[model samples]
Target: MRIAVAAPTGHVGRHLVPMLIRAGVKPLLLLRDPDRLAPDVRPEVDVAEVDLLDADAVVRAVSGVDALYWVDPPPAGHNPLAEYKLATASAARAVTEGGVGRVVFQSSVGAERRHGMGEIDGLAATEVALNATDANVVHLRCGYFFTNLEYQVDAIRAGALQVLLPVNQPMAWVSPRDIAEVAAGRLLSEEWRGRIVQAVHGPADLSWQQVVGIISEAVGKPLEVERIPEEEMRGTLAGFGMSAEQIDSLVGMSTGFLGGFTPEQERSVHSTTPTTLAEWAYTELKPMLQ
Candidate 1:
């Protein structure tokens, strides 16, 4: 199968590409900056330096590809929602015009609601467009990234974790590596058909308090969970140099996940992944704490 990966340098893409290679598939990488890809892996894959906003360019780049691994990359400009619409539209065009066979789209858990989730609304667009296509599409409705905890690294070390989410609500905090693993397994095989919603729920459902305990243990320090108010969180994001638009999106994301945010796809043996926070913290986060 002729496979293609967009944003091969991204958190999940980086992991996904190596898995594809190890599985003996040479993937065509569609990216804006070829140099962003690791120097060592560049030689093994086909590179197309095409901006995702350009439909013609993306269609051209992906033409004749059998499968595609597409995720709405982080907005390179200030208009994130606009970028998501255009990028997903371009990839969808590639599916139809370029005759791509399968699409493994990286979407978020709250995408089922499809709106009011700020940037996640953009991901929902990808799901909609792919679903319209004839190509086999699997929308990996992923959970809140474990990497998001990196934002609280300093706070965790200071013995207090100011969380934005409701402390009592259990959320699926997953590793990108695990998401990539599931995506690779799906892309490499052709067992299922139609639009499949697979939730990448890591190990177990965990509350913010439970998360803090696991993280605290890994960092070898006791930490407190301070659930900051939305406005305060706004100021914090602004302090970090996030623009107003980005802040609004994040704030909306918080509210969107509040109540009625349960994933449409119920957790089952297939939906749950194996990696736990303790395991990920020890390996990925513990080292970062140093």
Candidate 2:
């Protein structure tokens, strides 16, 4: 089977591509810069060097592919919603024009909510657009990525874990590996027809405090969990050179979480993956921190 993977070197795509190759399926990678792909994996899959924003180019990239794994890349500057809409629209057009048989979209947990969701609202919009298309579509509504902790490695090493939300509040988290695994399975099977929504949650819902404790044990050191106020989070993001829109979008996501906005329904047990906080801390987090 021939599959087209957008953002082939991205968080999930990096793992999904290798899994597809191992399954005896060929992947046509849509990469803006093919050089970003690992040298070793380049020989395994077909590469299409094309810009996703260009509708015509995207159509050509997915042409004749049996399935497309579409993941929206992080927004470049400010105005992530606009960026998402533009990219998703182009991709939708491509899926229709290219006659791709199936599509697996990477979305977020709070995407069902319309307001106060920040950037996740963009995923909701993307879902709407993709669902309107004639081809079979599967919306993979994923939870908070455990890999997001990689950004806190420096802070953890300094004995502090900074976050905008309350440490004691429970939140759902998922491993990128699990998301890739589910997407790969759907793409490889290509069986589900029409529209389907799958919630890819982690093994368990955990509080930030519990997660920090696991991190401390993994690194063999005590780490403090510091909660940054929403207003101050804006300043910190600004210091990091994020544009106003980018800062608002990110902070808005945290605000939504603090407000208790989350998935409306319970995720099925079948959708949950086996990776746990302790396991992720020992494997992915520890290696990055050390």
Candidate 3:
């Protein structure tokens, strides 16, 4: 049974590769830059060097593999949406042209909407294309990644957390490690067939206020949540030189969340993971601060 992991250097993929190894299954890794793989793991695994943006290349890379873990690489290009569509189209084409039987797509919480989700729309697009195929697919709709806080290193250090969502409203936050575990289970098992939407809701639904308190406790300091206005967020992204479409899409995403756009999949024991904000903060975020 051949299995391959694409974008193996990413947060979840990094964890997924090692988990697959521990399960005694050697996975074929597909990536754009082979050099980015951890030096320690490079000699222990097989790698196919290819540009993910190239559909023909991705098709070739996964051609004979029985299963694949497809996490679209972080959005890039002047138009990230277009880039996302291209990548999804490539993955869809692979299922048809490459003979890959199963795919566990790294999707997001709001992807079920399939429209008006900003950057999440790209993931919805991926879900749409893959769902059209006959191959087994799991739309792993993950929650807001806990790792996103790492981007707040500077902000956290400044004693403030800029949020796009309401501070007191509940929202899901998941660890990437949790996402990898779920993906690995699907890729490793053959019992489940056809397509399904598996939402990863993390350990709990936490409001930004609760999250801020957790981080403050983890770091032994005070932290505050500064709710950034949607239009202001647009200006900030524009200042960062994001494309117009990207800015609108990103602001649109925040607006949706600000409007309390929780996904339809209700929280259940299966959807909830084990890692909590406190655990991730102490283990992952604290170390980054040092």
Task: Give the alpha carbon lDDT tens digit for every residue of 150-247 in model 3.
Answer: 88899899998877777888888999999999999999999989989999999999889999999999988899998877778878888999889878
What TM-score would candidate 1 get against the native? 0.95
TM-scores, all models, native as reference? 0.95, 0.95, 0.97
Off by over 4 Å in 1: none
lDDT of 2 by residue, 75-172 (tens): 88578878988888877898889998899999888888856789988888888888889989999988889888887778888998778888898878
- Clash numbers, per candidate: 0, 0, 0
Among all candidates shown, the one with the greatest TM-score: 3
User: Which parts of model 2 are misplaced by more than 4 Å?
Assistant: none
Give the alpha carbon lDDT tens digit for every residue of 161-248 in model 1: 7767878889888888899999999889988888888899887888889988888888798977878898999998899888888887
Worst 10 residues of 3 by lDDT: 251-260
C-alpha displacement of 29 in model 3, angstroms? Answer: 0.7
lDDT of each: 0.87, 0.85, 0.87
Residue 159 in candidate 3, Cα distance off native in Å: 0.8
